[model samples]
Target: MGFTVRQIARRADGGEIIRTRAFDGAELSVGRGSDCDIQLADLGLMLRHARLRLAGDGRVAVEAMGGVPLEIAGAFVTRADLDPGDNPTIMLAAHRLTLARGEDGGVLVTAERVLAAGDGSDAASEAQVFTLKKTLPSKRRLAWGLVVLILGLGLALPLWVMAGRQTVLPPALVTAAARNAAPVATPASGWQPDRVWSSGPLSTAHAGLANSCGACHAKPFEATTDTACIACHTPAAIPAHAPAARLARGQVPATGLVADVHKAFNLPEGRCASCHKEHEGPDGALQVAENFCTDCHRGLAARLPDTRLANVPDWGGHPAFKPTLVVQPSLTAPRFERVALAGARETSGLVYPHQLHLSTRNSVANMVRAQGLPGKNGLLACNYCHVPDSDGERFQPISMEKNCAACHDLAFARDGGVVRTLPHGKPEQAAGIIRDFYLGQALSPRAGVAAADRRLPGSEARLRTLAFTSPAQARAQADAAIAGIFGKGGTCAECHAITDTGGANLLTRFAISPVTLADHYLPKGRFPHKRHLSYDGRTGDAACISCHSGVPRSNLASDVLLPPLSQCATCHGGPQLATAAPATCATCHGYHYGESGHGGDALRVRLVVARRGE
Candidate 1:
């Protein structure tokens, strides 16, 4: 059984207003404290005044606690018995509690304030004693007075001050001449009352707009419009997330009471100010909450049925990275395909075995140490060939001269005191240099082609025979040398794809296939190497090897050494997970742009594939 409590209050019109509540427990507690089952606001009442419970004789036992006396029927008693169908009134301080039987075989308690209650005959005297007419001013007059005061100071004063305010120029557009010029004294230049209406200090990016309220708040009593933002930020600088129609269809419909209020006010979505809030502080960062992205992207596929993007609720739901790779090798125009890392292969018209070069106990390692190349303990390091770009985010393109020329010597011939080397890139030039050297050697006296010294009287005919055969011999020698240079196991053929395009001369006979290596594998996602310079306190090659575990064992140039999705799960998880680093959508991917070179991949790979055509 439960205890039913009813609190009755008297209105000015002599009507009663009752509030009822039920508490389910074996006993009913009454006190002035908030923790009591039936609390009284009177200070005279003790914290634990009394308790009522069922007795063995089918009656309710009222027991006073903390040595408090209970006044029942004008008699002070420590304890009393209340029977069913019997109404007993208990008086404590200024409260009157009427006890009776409940409808559900429980105790019913009705409490009322009896401080002002008197005999029915002297109603006029009782009313005069409680009236506030002789004590203070009326409540209505005071309330109206406060309302007028607030409107005059908060609204009227600010409007009056803002009317004659001078305009402040944007900080970026301010010229040097304007700074050196003397300040123009005006009445509006002094302290103004409108400054009091400022919410807070502006952020560092919009600090110049602090004194320029009209810059953002174009209309009075209205929020900052997107037009004000577009004035400073051009459409080209900050492009829309997608086209209007598709973005609208993809947007998740807002719900809840707050959303209803916004809809009632006809609030529009996709506003700049909605995400990037201002007037927070001078140096506060504008961190968009993770929910803003997850709300729409969590179930985007259901809303945007035609979209090619997968629904990404959080980092745990992220798909495998698809890197743009050159599927077909070509010199003029290479074919590119976005394939998952598991099936990715790059035909860059070059052959390089990372395992062979990276080994510490092999011939490549011995050659590196013998030549004093960039390696540690005769082992080739990643930095020896792959150097970081200016930003240190990505590696620079590999070069034959800077990286390979030292080990792979191109010297084909040696003069008197000079070593002649073939040109690195120009295959035709290298062939011509070899041909010229052979032709010069054929006609030289050292070759004995036309030598007449220390010869017999009839040796002239033999000298003529030697000169005639020398040209034919020179041609054969040039052809053989050119074939060896451009053939398999040759210096030029070892790294590059040599194509034999026959021509009239030896110089134009061979062609080297063009090589294409993507600077960025994942154009849509950003991975900054500088930010992750160390892994568990391990730096340099150790840190890189932690993520790129397959590089050392990889033997084929076509093998993609990019880390898979599971590797990233080691340190990062969903934004809500406390066990790992929080990874929101914005952490690795930009809303409107990608990595540091915002112009390159950012403009190229727009996030959603549906908007790519438009």
Candidate 2:
């Protein structure tokens, strides 16, 4: 009998082929010619565009047709197969070959498995047929589909339901949700929600509340009965549980009472909702009336302090009340003049020639003509030195180095020349001389000495008496004597005095007074008084008069001109004016008047010493 290969089991290189029944329940001989390979004729059909179904058991079965040894096992099936050169014939399984037969009787299929013949047989075999079943989809794909459906329902259907429910919710419930959703704290992030007014159409006004409505009102659409609104929104009651809420009300205990009065008169009962809306239109977060505070406070001004309500005058008919001051703290009145001038007076008894230094016009004009220099550049007005007062009378301290030294060329001597150059004698000796002169002058009226008793006991005689004492004792005595003479409250009138006529005098009429040698003798490099007197009109006499003008109305100082430099260039300049002038220093040494033409021997020393010390 010619049998097909049912199921071929074989090993290569001379092993026996085991046979099994084909899918058609037939058996056949196993042989090499019985094996066949299958493939799809139309490859595009494998892709699933539409659902596919199987005939039975969700499978399609194929059978071996021709008399050839064939076999089928698991997913494998075989049909007739030809020898290597015999027209290449093949017996394909029907199910594995899914092509419509042409007029020439050909078949096509996508072979899932191949079968081989174990024995050479020309008969059909059960192992030569195979069946193919369509596969079921995996669980993961089904699960993903279900999830997509659920998400679609959640997004679309719930939104539709919420839209309908929003209209039906009682205003109280909606308001409760809004109030609960509001942030409890004053957002550190400073985010504020727009306000909504209930007066207008809800649709028109609700646009402003698109993202949030709880930003402004405590509760959105709730029953805002006067009691409920006043409890939280008004300033009168203390916000019990919420500190942020209290701050939002902006009504501190001191000012809250004032706000209450405003609400009582200006805003009516049911109308609270009008101005204090929950969610206003865009740009309505801070929309309270600016005059809300002042409207009520103006009537009660009599009861409040001027400080509490800045005393703004009512200008004719203009409304004087402003409410912005109540809300913004930075707009308060400025504090009036708090700077005092008590620490700016002179510490020394030297009378600053405020008036004499102020007369610059004549000196400046004459100097300008003589020097052929511009008059404008010669002298500055007095206001330059004595600064004006904007708010009140106040004197600023004069800088000795800057203002005084410009003309006086004097440096301040703290311990009466202790640390500076000595003039005509050692500083200690000069200090002693000054101390004795002060004491002798002090005792003169009592000692029955003549007013001309200006000289101290001869230096040689005084030294003979003091020579027997220790140096320490001498220093101590010198310090004591100097202190008594220049000590605080040491009878300034006895030496220095501001006369009614304002002309100072030493013996008869000194520039500074007291006839004491310490104030009398100074360094010699300071002002050259002779040069200043001869300062004709280099920059015009206006420059000379700039600082030498007399005081106005009185002989005291005035604010008219600055100090002049005519005295400085006089002695400091090169060459002498005439041959009669003496060269020896003694000609200008004595304290008496002479034909030497010197301003004064001691006065020159005082001026020069003051300058060098500076």
Candidate 3:
């Protein structure tokens, strides 16, 4: 029932010099008055400041003697319960008193003057007359001031402005808000007034919605709803690396305590902002790390058993590439199929014996060198025909006129300083020109006839008639010429696969080569050739043949020459792999549809909106 209160004090040197007093007290009087059981001489205290005693129910009670109250537990109160065993301390005026259990069930009281009394003549002291312990305003005073400032400015001022807005708001908006019983914002004064509650600056991308805090945090201090985001970001949903159902559908459920708590809260298993958090720092939006994507994709096969997606983790753990190729030989009817490039074959019609043309000692290379051609070192280079586009991302499709016409000539007939060239592509037209030439020969006067051959002027009409041949006979001669040119060893047959349309009754009809070449092999993955031109680890740049090793020996057009993933892994591999590239999940695979999505990120369009000044 009885206890002691010991007061601890520090001297000028910061040493703990302690002094104690044991007062015989089931009841004690503590004041500046003479008759008080505990006397204290502090100018700030009244004659009879407070009375302390043990209550009938075995608890200590302290009460003010008159109207003046004592500071109890940092609060001013007229009465308070004190358990000395708890080592309770109370303050009166400039003096601090502590109560504690003393020897033999008696209570001990300790007192010390903690602060200097305020000088009455000072201008600051005149403002607060009764304050002695604190010459300045106390913590309570400052705390109350802050509370008033927040409520009056952050909340109350905005409410007052909103009320003012309601009067002038257009009838349309006012009626809409009233009809729905919702507090919708109307155009207000320049001062946003409510921005005092804004946590921090919005990301540079989202800075357009800065003034409109309620655009996201609609409710006061409440979590943002999906509706807030969906309002503007409807079609462009946040990229959720993997589908939501994979992780959200747990079988036996999470067993750990933290997991249980999370489950109980029904926290979103796949929320957009979970990974893309905002208002963190001065830096705008930060990109999510590789762990965000790998976490869901690592063991995804087990989670979603029926998923059609190829089970792949990060770039290092990717599966073999699947390249799309046209299965049908003709462009008239398209058919596509994705097959692994390692053993994939192409059925592009023309046959290209790569070794014959590329060989240094071969006849074709020798002919190219004899002409002092566009190639280097008396040999054909890949770039001689495979020219890159303006951007150098990929090669332009090869053209016969631009790339091949220099070595091949179209001339077929020459007579008397007049040379006739057969049109390169038109077989029938070239034959007709040949037939007309022979008809002109039959009509011309013979050079050896001399005087007799000049029987001419009067007989010109007769001679011209002899030059014209029967349509059937002329067609037959033209067909023969066309056949010879389209045949196996003809000029046109050297490079192309010749096919006759089987016109037995009619003449000859030759069909040219049917070939289709794609500049890009893998449409889904972006491989910037410019970036890879210098991908050799130690040396500055690697040759194209380093990756396409089969190109030098690839004789047939059917050989699919794309390198396998193992070739790329020599430099680009796992972080722990010896290679320095350390490829991650984002190197090749894009999560979205456009160039903006090439790096698995959305294009953050920074709107240059005019900001409201502070």
Candidate 4:
């Protein structure tokens, strides 16, 4: 009814290890694979070597798998039947399997290893296996040969090339050489052995110095000198990031192996070439590591107690921005102070309620919609009055005539078909324009008047009530109108701070307080509005509100609407922060605060030398 397999393995110590397992089935598998009911460790045998099944007449059926024949009694057969009355044996490579009738009236197979393990007599010849060791040179000899080859190619050849010629000569030496030089053949310009020392191709900015290494190297094994850099880069072009004395005091001490190496070579902390590394390919020019700035700025206050700058290890550690605000308003020169954004207020000498202007449901928005004024979605938007400058880094100076004039016109009267607008900025000019207009109107005769109703010329009063007003009457009317215009609730008083000085004339009486608005709030940092015009697929008004959330809610023009540090942190963070945009010190600030440096170009230097006839 079932099949039983017994495996007998002989141990090296003359002990027999027998393992017996029974399968309650009509069939059993035999193979070299472990999953087979009867497994063998012979490489010659197929994974599924054979299958044993019990026939209907109680005979054991042996069938070979994968065309592998089974040997039985000196005869090989793919399939064979053995009766219980006659026991039979089958060969499977190194092992032999015997078939017999079990006590349960089922097939029983006993297997044993006939051949011993590790018998390598059938292995390939030793000469074929050890061919590499016999043919090739020894490891030690080959290593020595490589060492000598490297020394010649890397060190000896480069030294020879460097000793033969100086790639670049001084300007003065070049001038002298040109005058005394005779016609001589020069070496073909191509790759030199010394170029092997370069880590990578030269940056685009330093591409001209690729062949002429002496321009920067000057000495064979010494670091580049600042004197060579200063010869061309004028102080105006690359001014110190800060005063040198203060910078030295504030600079953090260098650490680690790299710093130790620099110190060993007598290299100082603040070297020009330290940050502006070369030979890193075209795109690597002017690239500074994030740690270069963070190391010093992280704990700068601890090093220099008198420093005004706060220690900022990352964006999250950055203090609130201190904007330059016009603290004291003056007619000539306004006094400014750097105040933190928390309570910063600017006295621009103007009255404007942002809430009133920016409100969607207010009169300003209604008026804009009714009069077809500029706005986004028929509502007053920030761009209506505020306009970005050419570079979009900051806004253009707000002009009353250009920005406010569309909604708030200055027209007081009309002359024929021409609308006469009061002159802006100058109170004296505005008063004169108004006075002259009234005077001209009073002096002129009525357009539709009857001559018959008029008295004779001698009897006619020069101050005519119905026809023409007198000069004094015209002057009074002009003065009254001028007072109303410059006074509270008037057109001029709406935006400006008006002061009435007691004077005999209308022109000298009214004075408008001067306005001084900051062009840039944080002068030390740069914020490009162009890049921030859109955020998270939101453009136009929505993008603007994302940062300037306080703009619409602000009632006073003096209120600083500049977003706090938290606003920028929503999207931007330190270089290591993965959740936000990476922002390093160089992203907003520059090392060279003055105008950008020049004169590095080799072509320009050649042109200058040509001009000087040297």
User: Residue 505 of candidate 3: its Cα lDDT?
Assistant: 32
Candidate 4, after superposition: displacement of residue 267 in Å?
2.4
Task: Report the lDDT tens digits of candidate 4 across residue range 245-277.
Answer: 877887776789978998778678887876777
- Relative to the true structure, candidate 4 reaches a TM of 0.65
Clashes of each: 0, 93, 8, 0
* Candidate 4: regions farther than 4 A off: 1-149, 156-192, 201-212, 255-260, 279-285, 330-332, 361-363, 370-373, 445-468, 595-614
Report the Cα lDDT for residue 609, model 3: 18
Query: Relative to the unseen true structure, what is the C-alpha lDDT of residue 437 in candidate 1, on a scale of 0 to 100?
Result: 71
Clashing pairs in 1: none
TM-score of model 2 (CA atoms): 0.19
TM-score against truth, every candidate:
0.65, 0.19, 0.53, 0.65
Model 2: per-residue lDDT, tens digit, 78-164?
332222112222233322222222222222122221344323221233233331222545578778988887765644544444344
* Structure candidate 4, residue pairs in collision: none
Tens digit of lDDT per residue, candidate 3, span 1-614? 35454545656676776655555446777776778766666656677788888875455789988878778888888999987788788887667887777666666678776765353422335455665656667789989999999999989986655444422224443344234333233433344676787667656445544455566665555555556655544424434334346546522234588677756554354555655566754343444556666776677667767654554567667778666565544546444455777688866666666676677776666667776665655567777777777767677777667766555545444454444567765666766666665555445522221101111111221112122245555456545656666766666776667787877632246776665555455655666566666545422212677887788788887788888889888778765567767755656656544322222332122112111110
Q: Model 1 segments beyond 4 Å from truth?
A: 1-154, 166-201, 255-260, 263-266, 280-286, 330-332, 444-469, 501-505, 594-614
Give each model's whole-structure lDDT: 0.71, 0.30, 0.59, 0.71
lDDT of 1 by residue, 155-216 (tens): 89878766766656564533321332322222223444656777886675665556667777
lDDT of 2 at 45: 20
Ranking by lDDT: 4, 1, 3, 2
User: Which consecutive 10 residues in model 1 have the weakest lDDT in total?
Assistant: 451-460
